[model samples]
Target: MSIQLIHAMNDLTATHKDLLELSKRKTEALTNNKLDEFQALLLEEQKLIRQLEKQEQKRQEAAEAWKDEQHHPAETLTITEILGRLDVEEQKMAEDAAVALTDTIRELKRQEHLNKALLEESMKFVQLSMELVNPSIQSMNYGTASSDKMSGRSLFDSKA
Candidate 1:
């Protein structure tokens, strides 16, 4: 294998480590309600994943060429032939990564939808309770505004 191939593999390994670390940090940010930080970390992780994929492609191509030469000892493969194999491997990796990323992003979106619905439902329950105890809130104008405001009507209303 060429020195370049070794370098590519090493680069991919480093990128993978960075991605894993970023993933952990993102999870921590999520737990701490640091959504902005979590999103930033996610973007950085994705970029690193792409870099890793690119390097892996180069390594795989070089390895395949080395294998082909070993398999056909009577003939030497042209540089172009080796590069062709590498290109094919790189393209395949790109497609696979795209599909994986798409699926993951879709799942995250679905989970976000569910979470939003749950939050809305919880707010509804709280609003219902306030209305039950203070029947005056059911009417727009019954008790003093401050009384309804303090009782949590304004709280849920502001949310809406």
Candidate 2:
């Protein structure tokens, strides 16, 4: 395996694990009324997701290049016929690659969407489970607020 490919795969897996941890953090933060931390972790996860996507793109590019090389025109021919025949085969191969890339891009995009949804659903389950366990830790309002003046603001608001 390519060093870059290996690193990319490792990074992607690490990022996914980080995202899972962030989801857990969000659940805890919401339970403890620390919405700020929850939002911060969510943002970090989003950033990591974007990075992971970029790495995926790079991997795809490398794979496409390898496929292109594999379909190169057959070696050896009459010196005169070589250039013309090579051009034809190269064009055919390129067209084939274009079609393959389009299909693969669509499929990968769909998979990415599904992965996002799965993570979101998992987070929802976490939040719901926390609710079930404590039953009073709070919903989305965090810990609740006093009725005093300048109160009832978002949980993210400064306490001091």
Candidate 3:
């Protein structure tokens, strides 16, 4: 049982490593503003995310089975908690998996933060371009102006 749990953790560790690599690629794509490449990478990321969800389900099942056999409750348990109940060798394997998973998650988060900043910067640049192109339009207001003299024409009209 402990061996099975160890195997599951090792599988999770590998998949998380792959996810970290994918996140790095996503950050690169976003920073470069490669829309085609970014879309392809997003699809790939979604697929891997589904795989990770399945692996999580498997890990949960294994954890529950181990808990039941040991007369432990069915409550949610972290990998470290489960490792505490295992033998010496299995505990070592689980510990290694935990460490690898933690490192991969940390790196992934860093990449995601960078990507978010890049995306926000791009959006701000686009908004600035829009403002420059249409200086008359305060914004895309859809009516409800404070005056009755103001025209009801669309705010996006370039000729107005």
Candidate 4:
């Protein structure tokens, strides 16, 4: 049982590592405005989330089993509490998994925060450019400008 618990922890750790790598790639894609690449990364991220959810379920089951064997209540337990119920060797495995997952998640969050800021800046720049090109239009009234009204396209559209 403890061995199974260790395996679950290992799986969770591996998933978190994969997510960290994907998050970095996502950051790059967002920063470069690579819409196609960003869409692909989002799909991959969704699959990873599914795997992570499965792993979490396995871990929770393991925790419940350990708690039961120890005669503890059947309440939901934190990872730390579950680790306490594990044997020495299994405890080490759980601890390592916890630490690795935590660190990877932290780094992923930092990169994602940076990517969000970059996206916001890019949107702001696009808005400023639109305002510059069509000073007569306020709040994107396409009919306000003669060129916009005639072409039925944005000022930034090359074909317009």
Candidate 5:
């Protein structure tokens, strides 16, 4: 059971590393404004995320099974708690797997944050471009109070 738990943790770590790589590529795609590449990365990311979720579920189940076998009284058990019941060799493996997974997930979060900021900036740029291309007449008006009263009139009077 401990072995199963360790295996699940290792699998999760591997998947997380792959996701981190994808995140790096996505950041590059966003930076370069490669819409097609970005879209492809998004699809790949989704697939990985689904796989990660399944791995997480399996890890949880393994942990639960270990807890049951060990006769742990707690309704829920953490990896650290489970580690206490493991032998020295298994403890080391689980610890290493957990640490690696944690580090990779942290890095992935940082990369995702950067990507989000880039996307927001891109959206702002597109909005600015659209406004420039089709600015409202009200926005074009920069007149004093008296001129403001002639709101509906054309800027240039043909009869003048």
Candidate 6:
């Protein structure tokens, strides 16, 4: 059971590493403004996320099984707790896997934030360009009260 748990953890770590790589690629796509590539990456990311979810479920089941084997009374078991019951070599393996997974997850989050900022900046640029091309009407209010009626009118007539 401990072996199964360890295997599950390693599998999860591998999947996370894959996801981290994808995130880096996504960042590149966003920076380069490659909409098609970004869309493809998003689809790939969704598939990876689904695989990760399944691996996570398997890990949970393994942990529960290990806990049952150990006769642990708690409703939940932590990796540390599982480590305590493992042999030295197994403990080392689990600890290394956990650390690798944690680091990958942290890096992925940072990359995601960076991508979000880049996307937002891109959107702002597009919006500014659109406004420049077709600006909305605003009140000039430089004339008499009668000019107030023209507040909502466009400066240039499109039908002209």
Off by over 4 Å in 5: 142-146, 149-160
Q: Which stretches of candidate 4 lie over 4 Å from their true place?
A: 136-160
Model 3 lDDT tens row, 1-160: 7667767777877888888888788888887779899889889989988998998888778877888888887477777677778888878878887787778888878878887888899899998998888865445454555444566655698886
Ranking by TM-score: 5, 6, 3, 4, 1, 2
Compose the digit string of candidate 6's lDDT tens values, residues 1-160. Answer: 9889888988988998898899899989988889999999999999999999999999999988888889999887888887887899999988988888888889888988988999899999999998888865553335566567887898899998
| lDDT value, candidate 3, whole model | 0.80
TM-scores of the candidates in the order shown: 0.43, 0.40, 0.79, 0.74, 0.88, 0.85
The residue pairs in collision within model 2 are: none
User: Candidate 5, which ten residues in sequence have the lowest lDDT sum?
Assistant: 137-146
Error of 5 at 8 (Å): 0.4
TM-score for candidate 5, please give it.
0.88
Top model by lDDT, which number? 5
Give the Å error, residue 50, model 4.
1.7
What would the per-residue lDDT of candidate 1 be over residues 1-160, giving only the tens digit for each residue? 5445545545655565555556556555654667688668768867876887787789778666676654745354443344444556654554454345445546555555654565466568779998887866547666676485788545456655
In each prediction, how many residue pairs overlap at the backbone (N, C-alpha, C within less than 3 A)? Answer: 0, 0, 0, 0, 0, 0
Residues 1-160 of candidate 5 have per-residue lDDT tens digits of 9999889989999999999999999999999989999999999999999999999999999988888899999997887898887889999998998899899889989989999999999999999999999997667766575686988899899997
lDDT of 4: 0.81
Among all candidates shown, the one with the greatest TM-score: 5
Error at 77, model 3, angstroms = 2.5
Candidate ranking under lDDT, highest first, comes to: 5, 6, 4, 3, 1, 2
For TM-score, candidate 1 versus 4, the one ahead is 4
